[model samples]
Every structure is written in structure tokens, then in C-alpha cells.
Target: MYITMEPGSELAWELYAGIDEAGRGPIVGPLIIAGVVISGKCMNKLSTLGVKDSKQLTKAQREKLIDVIYESARYIIIAEIPPHLIDAYNINMLEEDTIAYLVSRIVAVNSHLKLKEISIDAVGSSKQLAQKIREVVPKSVRVVIEEKADRKYVAVSAASIVAKVWRDRRIDALKTIYGNFGSGYPTDPNTRRWIHDMYSLDPYNPPPIIRRTWGTLKTLAPLWYKKKRQTVAGREKTQKTLADFLPKI
Candidate 1:
């Protein structure tokens, strides 16, 4: 879907791209990263596609626009980072890694075109995240990471919609097995209650699909970490006490 930035600004860049993600806040699904590339010439066409922030579009509208985006964009790339990796790396790192991965894919696709400018919705501190990305990205490309980029940039909005639509589909499929988990945000009491109940009955073990590293998981499974921490702390304390008591030469 084509979304236009408010008129009266000169468009400086030739090949502008936007990057965004979905499933970052959701507790139960993979994080999805998406990138969309557009040129000034095609901006009107994109606007014609009814592209706006994915949140603004109805499900039907989003579904309809997905095809249009695919057909019209110079490039679109999406990457899904699974739950186990999120548990291993932590969410912030996962977000960074996912962006890095998606950006790499965009670079690969644009390699033939020799494009320079790319924009991404700020995942963390825009400056820091952009710096981290730059450290990993090749020197030839320029990266711009900005806060609320999805709303400000049409490319970012398209990426946001693509990622959100993909993640929503994943969530719906998961509901078939796990039942209703709500929106999977910690703010959703239903999601929290479902997680608490799942762990209460199972203990130490969570459903295979749940992101165990989430704050909700940590809160519900305090004893799991507490016991482990206590065991280590107790061992260190005992070692110190034993050393004090030992005779020294």
C-alpha cells in the first residue's frame, strides 16, 4: 500500500528503503523483520497501493495490499527469528541481530543496483543501533535508523505491515494448538494468566513455543533462577568460609 509523507518536502534520495519488525512485544512467536525499497518515481504507486502503517489497516486491507507491495516494490525481504534463539540471546540482542540480518538481505538484493541510502525504524537507541549496524555493514552503504520511522517513512510502514501480517498469521496458527493466548503482550492479562497457569501445572517446563526469556516467564519462574543463583551463591560463601578456617603456612 502506498502511503505518502505530507507534501512540500523535497525528496532527496533516489532509492529509499524502510525497515521494521513485528513480534518484538509478543511473548509467543518469532520476531519478524521486513524491509521495503521504493524510489521517488514509484512513491505515488505505493501510495495508491493503500500503504499506511499496518496498525491503521484492517486485516482485509492489509491482506489485499500485501500482494500489491510485493509487485510494486524494488525489493522486499523478511526474516523470522525463532523462540529458542530469543531465549538464548535475549530480546534486545535478538532485535539487533534480526535487523542486521534483514539489512544484510536488503544489501544483497540491492547489490546489483548499487544503492546507497536505507532507513530503518529505530529498534533501540537509534544512534547506538545504527552504529552497531554500521559496524557490521559494509562501508559502501549508508544506514539511517530513526525513531517512529514507520510513521514517518512509507518504506518503513510497508515493512511494518508485512512483518505484522506475517506475525499475525503465525499467532493465529499457534492458537490452534495452544488456544487463545490473547495478543501475547505482557500487558494482556489473559496472556499472562495463560503463561502462569501453564507453568503452574508443568513447573520448570514451559510450552515448547513460549519465549521463556520474557519478563513474564522470569516472573512466573522465579524459583527456577532463584534456586540456581542460590546454589552458586551458597557454594561461593561456603568456599570462602572453608578457606578462612584452613591453616595457612
Candidate 2:
């Protein structure tokens, strides 16, 4: 059941929530947004259970904690924006829209839940982004958007774990379909190699999964390299060839 609350000023409830995402920087896989809601009783317990930040935890630990978070979370929800959609839209706008949607959906789905506040790890380190999130949500849900919110808030940390786990599962699925691409970042040599192979095999048409808009593709791919080569060839010709009717003095 979905419930929409009247937009109100900043509110305070005992229940707290944390928001975070994973796959934000990856060149492969969908970006994930996750939020977990916890009341006063479980917030402290979550911290004690070693919930810090997803990046700080091992894969096994994150898997183990997903169950724990589920057991304790009053409401948990995630939204994923796939690579194609990501390419279609502005990333920052997509992030803000997705975050606003996730938080609002959680609160709306559990209309009975009396959440006091939510803290999010800012996407690009801006308070205005937080304010943008808050403005879309029910005004009663006070938002504390800031940098490192996942590290600062146990709830955000738990959410981060869920997000990372979700991203990993998707990455695993993608590997099954497309073979392996290492860590799916530009820094990974294996990833770069896969891209190079793709670019060579299909210079003008790499797989849709590849973010063609990304600089990595345009800079490293053969299409741009071939164009550069042709440009240099033209320049070299212009330099060497003199006019046929040049006057001999």
C-alpha cells in the first residue's frame, strides 16, 4: 500500500535511515541505490555488529550482514539504473531522481513507519544535493546529506553493504553473459584489454554495454585512434607536397 504524507517542515522521529549506492564509478554493471530503515532499538545494535562502510567489509561479511540488516530493517528498498538508461540520462540528475524515488518509495510503502531522519553519502559532495533530495521527499523526513555518510552513520553503512552486494550480483550476472572484464573500471588492465578487443573487432560499434559516451572509450578505442592517424596523414601530406606551379627564382 502506498501512502503520501502531507509535505511538512523538517521533522524528527526516533527511527533513522541511511542511504548509499554502489557501482557509481564502475564502467560496467548498473548503478544501485539502497536504503535501510532502523529505529532507535536496532541502530546501536547494527553498529556493534561491525557495520561501518561496505568498502571496509569483505564480500563474505557483506553477504552475512545482508541477512542481519533484513532482520532488523523496518523497510529496505533498492533502485537500479542500468547502463543503457544511465547513458540516456544525465548521471547526476539520474542519481538525485533515483535517491528521491527510493527514499520516498520506502516511506510511502511503509506508510505506517515513523521515520525521523535519513542520512545519505552525497553523490558529489554537495549540501545542495541533499537539499534537493529532501525537497522531493515528504518534508517530515528530515535529511542529513553529507560526504561519507556511510562511514559516519551505521544505517548508511548497512545500506552501503546491501548496495554493494546487489552490484556484485549484477556484475556476476554480466560476467556470465559477456565473459570477464576484470573489476569493470578503467584502471583494470583486464577491463582495458577487453575494451581494446571490442574496439578492434567492432570499431564503430562496440557492445551497448560499453559506455560509449565515456572518455575512456573515445580516448582508448580504435575509432578515435584511426581518426587521429588519418588526420596526421593529411598533415604530413600538406607538409611534404609543394604547389605544382611554384615559380623557380
Candidate 3:
């Protein structure tokens, strides 16, 4: 005969988690933070979903897998930092802060779901980002930041999928109002041309969604400054020319 054990006999000790960001490389739109908590059993479910790096999956695939992963995972949290805040602080610091904030929120929401370990796709140097996270997060949680955690870790890949899907949806919504600005990354010629064209028409006017502090903004700055200088010079020259042409008074 076997003896019965107490309830909660199989309490999971170390919970594995993953965190990653999307829209960081984009010249426009907000940055998205995604965090996922996966128990050992849930890992097999993610593999069944064919969850991979967001970059590897097509838009349709990523969108489809998002719902699957959301349902399969133990917990998932996503947060966004709008372009204006990204502009207020540089991307590096903004991302660091966003990740820290997301992790804290996740812990608060899942207090019973004791998470002992977390893995993050590092935005900066792995060492630096990891240290920054530790400094901000409560002393209880242990975090490990790795360069390609999203690629190596199934949980991280799931987080990447959610972040990408959310960000792409936001971009699509913006396009409905603003038209197709392309992928929103600097590498996209269409995005660059759109920035150039918009600023050409009105230097002071920028699409409210675009990050004004980006290098693209700095590139446009010189043109606007040059035009301002030329306008001032032209006015000065016109005044001098008029004075010379005037009859002696």
C-alpha cells in the first residue's frame, strides 16, 4: 500500500521566463516589450506551435502563432513605450527602463506563480543590460540577459512573436491614417523617402507618431537650418538692396 502525500507536493520551484523587445530598430513607432512565463510542460506546447524568432516568421505566421502561444503559455505580458517617450530618452535608456517596468508588472500580476529565473534578449551589452535590470528589479528575482536568447530559448522566441505581432498591428493601424510608410526601419527606402518628403513640405511638421530624436530627425535638421539661414540672409540682402536703390532722404 502507498501513502498519500500532501497537496502542493509538486510545486514548481524554478519558473523559466523570457523577455524581448520589438520596434527598437524602427525609425518610427513605439517600442514594445514582451515577457512570457513558461512552465516545463508548456515548453512542449510552444514547440508544437512552431514558435521561432519573430524575424524568421512571415507576418501571417507570426500573427497566427500569437494566439496559439497566448493560449498555451502560463503567463505573458506586453508593454509599449510611445515614440514621444522614446524621443524624451535615448533608445538605449528607454528600452532598459521599459524592460524593467514590464518585468515588475509581470511579477505583481503573477504573485502566486513564483518565477525564480528570467532570460532576456539583450538590447545593449548583455552584461550591462543584465546589471541594469538587477539594479531596478526587486532582489528576489534572478535575470539572465543573453544576446540571442530569443533564438536559443523557446520561451524567448514566444515573447518575440507576441512583441512583433503587437507592434506590426500598431503599425498597420497607423498606416490606415498616414498611408504605407513601409516597414518603419531605417533600412527601408520608402520610410526614408517618406521622412524626406514630409519634412520638405513643412520642416516643423512631423508625423506625431515618428520619433523626432532619431538620426533621421537629425539628418533633416541640417536642411531646415540651412533653409532658415538662407531665408534670413535673403531678407537682409533685400533690405540692403532697397536702401541702396532708395533716393537720398
Judging by TM-score against the true structure, name the best candidate: 2
lDDT of 3 by residue, 89-201 (tens): 54565566567666665566556766777788988556656776776556777777878889988888988998899899989999998778899987798988877887777
Stretches off by above 4 angstroms in model 3 are: 1-14, 135-142, 218-249
Cα RMSD, model 1? 11.6
Stretches of candidate 2 exceeding 4 Å from the true structure: 1-13, 125-127, 222-249
Best-to-worst lDDT order: 2, 3, 1
What lDDT would candidate 3 get against the real structure? 0.71
Residue-pair clashes, model 3: 0
**Model 2 / residue 15 / CA error / Å:** 2.0
How well is each residue in 7-124 modelled by candidate 2, as lDDT tens digits? 2212234678788999878776788888887777788888889888999999999999888887877777777767765665556656775676677666665566677788888885
Better of 1 and 3 by TM-score: 3
- Report per-prediction Cα RMSD to one decimal: 11.6, 14.5, 15.6
Worst lDDT run of 10 residues, candidate 2, spans: 240-249
Clashing residue pairs in candidate 1 are 1-49, 1-51, 2-46, 2-47, 2-51
Candidate 1 to truth, TM: 0.75
